[model samples]
Target: MKISAAARFRRALLIGAAALASLAPLAPAQADGLPDPGFQIVQGQTALLVTDPQNDFLSPNGVAWGVVGKNVEANGTIGHIDQLFAAAKSSGMPVFISPHYYYPTDHGWRFEGALEALMHHIGMFDRKGQLTTEGFEGSGADWLAQYKHYINDGQTVVTSPHKVFGPETNDLVLQLRKRGISKVIIAGMSANLCTEAHMRELLEQGFEVMVVSDATAAAQLPGMDGYAAALANFRMIANHVADTGTVVGAIRANHHK
Candidate 1:
């Protein structure tokens, strides 16, 4: 007996639905996981520019210290940063270092109110101790001395951009563009505030951005999960969120080319 026309139509519809269901998983994956952006690798077309990886920002002795201060020093982000610097030097890729330094406050009561005031009130800030016209000096200067091997080895090019924010200072964006750098690898201290701001600006400017997860830190604010939140926001806006290992692999991959 021949099947009825209605039954054949129903069978076709069911098969079509089943096929669609089978493809549903792939649909989201395809939509979400596009091939790594062109800037994923450190070679050929991208530059590895670390933001404010200075003694003050990355070291406990720095004014804007973070929970990762000791960890960053111990885990060799300092050394890894140096290695990246060396790679850039060898490849002639521009390695920009945005160190944080401030001129002496010629005027007294420069920063009287706001968060600085609160930090001071809570003994978080000090004038002669933490705030001074010191750069690559004092105990904070130790890391720079240790990492000087990379500088002396001709493995790194360093530039200090003094601004309230790293990405905004010293025509950094312009310089990067001039060097034909379309992708920026960002890592540094206070991930939630400065790093987050930089990532937003970079994304807005249409440059592919990658935040090295392991190389950044956040303040241990009370009841504030600033670091994790910053990472989440960065992951959403950035071209990719990679750890130091992935970043290293990408850089090495570029070297082979």
Candidate 2:
């Protein structure tokens, strides 16, 4: 069986092309218009991670309402976050909360970022003391009234407060890892800051993160649309981004009540 020189040359070229193709790096998601890399809601392995679900962020009378209220109402963020809480609890999925608090001592810091300075000036999430409930009941640092039931439940894990935007300063990752949570369905207040930061960090920590878009809102300044910014980042960074209804449906479908 003798092969022609031309045929052998063509075969060599094909083999070389295939080898090169195998070595080529795949195009990034954004470069290819971003295909959806979906995530599954496995009951025990996946948990709901909500950040800064507090009075200051969600309540109409709280300190940050001036900047965050409009976006919150428009997105129904408060309600959506509650829905996620309900779904997670009913489905027996773990729920982890990452709250934010600023004590009197935090105000004494030498320097702070723009938002941190503003937060201190405005006294957002200011508690009486770390260990005292004195002025904490109705304060900005307290949990939103409606969410208290879910959050206060003995089963939910509330990690120490994240002083800044992300969970880096908190024990959230430790809590999640201890519970065997490798996939996180994330939601909560001030989307552009805490929510996005959590998504980025958890992804870096080797967890599959899916963001619940409508369940979080952000401060929309005159020139800064934080919610819009957060949405863009969520699409680019998270394994998937979905609405509250869609996420709740997934949770219910995947786990029995």
Candidate 3:
């Protein structure tokens, strides 16, 4: 039987695809020799660190909502963070919020990065001024209404806003060190940006950091999946990356024990 050239080409393509598929694992563990140094929540020594839990990153009307809202909803980030807050408060564990804010003076910077420029252009986390709370209520820089109860409680340590992605320029390290917090459970908005940055800096500062996998989300652009990227980094870099339910369970179990 004489086979047609086009039919032969099709057969070759199918064979190539099948060969490629066969080369791939049915279920890759993705942890090729990676070690997960698990974290244990301890009273007084462990704290909850939430980054950028403000309207700009967590609210529907935020400027960056169009880019990040999908992931936020998919991960149930808002409710998860609320749960962490409640757990921390009930457990008598300290809660630290590393907020992100940009005052009017910040806009006059001579140079900025890509996201910085975009954030400035879009007015994300823009506040009236540092000295006054005027027009701050319900603004992008303001805390999400639901989180206000937890954050404004006299106990929660709200650090100065981190202007950039990380806590390098902020007093987060000082606050943590002063409180003798050696372990931190981190969660919050825009997973790849502020949340991940906080994790990295805290780890560098000698804090055993565990990132809440679903309690944080990120912007998903056409070619970029910020959430996926952040997830990969969290698994590879943090002491442990667990889902909200697991983390919440651990917190409750630790406190109840």
Per model, state how many residue pairs clash: 2, 0, 1
Per-residue lDDT over 1-257 for candidate 2, one digit per residue giving the tens place of the 0 to 100 score? 99999999999999998876664544234454775678988878999999999999899898989999999999999889999999999999999999999888898999988999999999988987888889888788989999999999899999999998888999999999998999999999789999999999999999999999999999989999999999999998888999999999999999863
For model 2, the run of ten residues with the poorest summed lDDT: 23-32
lDDT of 1 by residue, 126-155 (tens): 223234544334444233565555444544
Candidate 3's residue-wise lDDT over 187-240, tens digit each? 997799999999998898888999999999999999999999999899889988
In order, the Cα lDDT scores of the candidates are 0.61, 0.90, 0.90
Top-down lDDT ranking: 2, 3, 1
Best by TM-score: 2
How does model 3 fare in lDDT? 0.90
Give TM-scores for every candidate, taking all chains together and pairing residue i with residue i.
0.67, 0.88, 0.87
Prediction 2 global C-alpha lDDT: 0.90
Candidate 3 accuracy as TM-score: 0.87
Query: In what order do the candidates fall by TM-score, top score first?
Result: 2, 3, 1
